[model samples]
Target: MSKILLVEARLHLRDGASLLFTIALPLMLLVFLGRAAGPAFPALMVMLSVLTLSFTVLPTVLATYRHQGVLRRMSTTPVSPLRVLAVQLLINLVVAVVSTGLLMAFGPGLPRNLPGFLLVFVLGTAALMAMGLVIAALAPNGKAAPTIGSAVMFPLMFVSGMWVPREYLPEVVRVIGDYSVAGPFARALGDTWVGQAPHLPHLLVLAVGLVVSGALAVRVFRWE
Candidate 1:
């Protein structure tokens, strides 16, 4: 398992295109929008990092392995397919962390409420990544995984205030966005960044989503 994790991490690093794009896109956005975009952009970009790994990179990698019979062949060996999946997830987590770190380095100051921010970040990452796992498990093939992930990603982005800030949206749309996973995610993180305690309702939503989605993903995951 350790070896697999190391190899996957190295492979992710070696993939220059992926590494550059994931790291670069957020950094560029920060440099350009950091001043004008206000406090929420940093958290949004962090969420974007998580989203990229979850909805884009993760599903493609897992589904491709299944499509190419890698997972199937691994079944003949002592290693469990779950181990490979875990390693893939661990690698992506590193990617997300690095991406977020870069944004923090160049973009904005640290979150005012350090502990609160950390809690929101951890829960948000888990909830979003678990959603990605479900997409990976259900996708029929490598090509389809990205498509499905993207389909899911755009709406979440919209509701999460990627396109329009939640504050600017009308009451109806704001209400919908509030209920969406991305909505509470951004809210909790934003609140913590500004030194305010995250709202209980937002934390509760994330906790429930994390538990329910993770359980479903594990239950439905396929080795091949």
Candidate 2:
């Protein structure tokens, strides 16, 4: 497992595009948009990092591995195919953590409610990653994964107030955003960023999303 993890981490490092998008892009956006975003800036940066990994990086890598027979080859080895999936998840989790640290260190401010922020971050990331796994499971080929992921990502981002402030969104849209995983995740992080405990409803939504999406991904995922 350790050997596979090290090898996979090296491969991920070599994917310059994914590294730039996942780590560098968020920081760049923060420099340009932080003032406009106000206190929510850190939350937005964190969300951007998470979404990039969940929608763009995770699914694309898994789908590409499947398409190129990497997973199949692993299945034939002594190592379990499931171990690869776990390793990928761990690697992405580390990236997200590092991204968050950078945002807090170099960006505008720290998360005021550290414990609450951590709680929301964990549930939210797991839920989003589970959704990405679903995309990976359903994608027909490597090329199709990003297409499908982007299709899903943009709408969720809009609803989550990535493009527009939540205060400015239509009432109907706000309500829909409240229930969406990205929505609650954003709101929860925002709450914690400002020193408030995350809303119970947001936490519940994320928890439910994690359970349902995780189950679906497990059921639908293919080793080959």
Candidate 3:
């Protein structure tokens, strides 16, 4: 497990240029936008919201393995497929922590509240991880990975309140975005990062989505 985790971690850090782009580019964007937006941006809140994708990396990577038959090869060995999945998840988590550390190096100063912020962070993480599994299950192949990733990510960025705060969006977009998985995710994460309430709707939608997605992943997943 440790070996697999180490290998996956290194791959993401080194070979996975796309992962770096997804992670670092956003941080840079947050920094620029946070500065540009001034008090308008809510830096910590938006920064925390990016973690949704970072956390999902493990699932996506695992999907790559499944789509490529790497998972199937691992299954023929003594190592259990479940263990491989566990290690991949652990690697992704490490990446998330490391990524968070890099962001906090210039965290743009957190808001006064701590507890409310933490709740949203935890909940947002859960939602993101669940979505990752859904993608892993649904994606057709390695070539499809990036497409699926972007499809999920783009909407989350726009609808979830990350791109434009809910208050700023037009009523129709806001109404739709408000209930969207990403919007609530952003709302919950935004609130928590700034030390606010759980934004229950966001967390609940995510929770429900995870449950549904997880079931689908199990149904469709192949070691190969």
- Rank list by lDDT: 2, 1, 3
> Tens digits of per-residue lDDT for model 2 on 109-202?
6889999999999999999999999999999888999899999999999999988998999999999999889999999999999999999999
Residue pairs with backbone atoms closer than 3 Å in model 1 (clashes)? none
Report the poorest 10 consecutive residues by lDDT, candidate 3. Answer: 40-49
lDDT of 3 by residue, 96-158 (tens): 555555555665665435566555555555556666766777777666765776776776677
74-187 in candidate 1: lDDT tens per residue? 999998787998899888888888887888789777888979988988888889889999999999998899899999988988877789877787788888778777789988
The candidate that achieves the highest TM-score relative to the unseen native structure: 2
| TM-scores for the candidates | 0.95, 0.97, 0.82
Question: Judged by lDDT, which candidate is best?
Answer: 2
Shift of residue 134 alpha carbon in model 1, Å: 0.7
Give me the displacement of residue 144 in model 2, in angstroms.
0.8
Q: Which stretches of candidate 3 lie over 4 Å from their true place?
A: 38-60
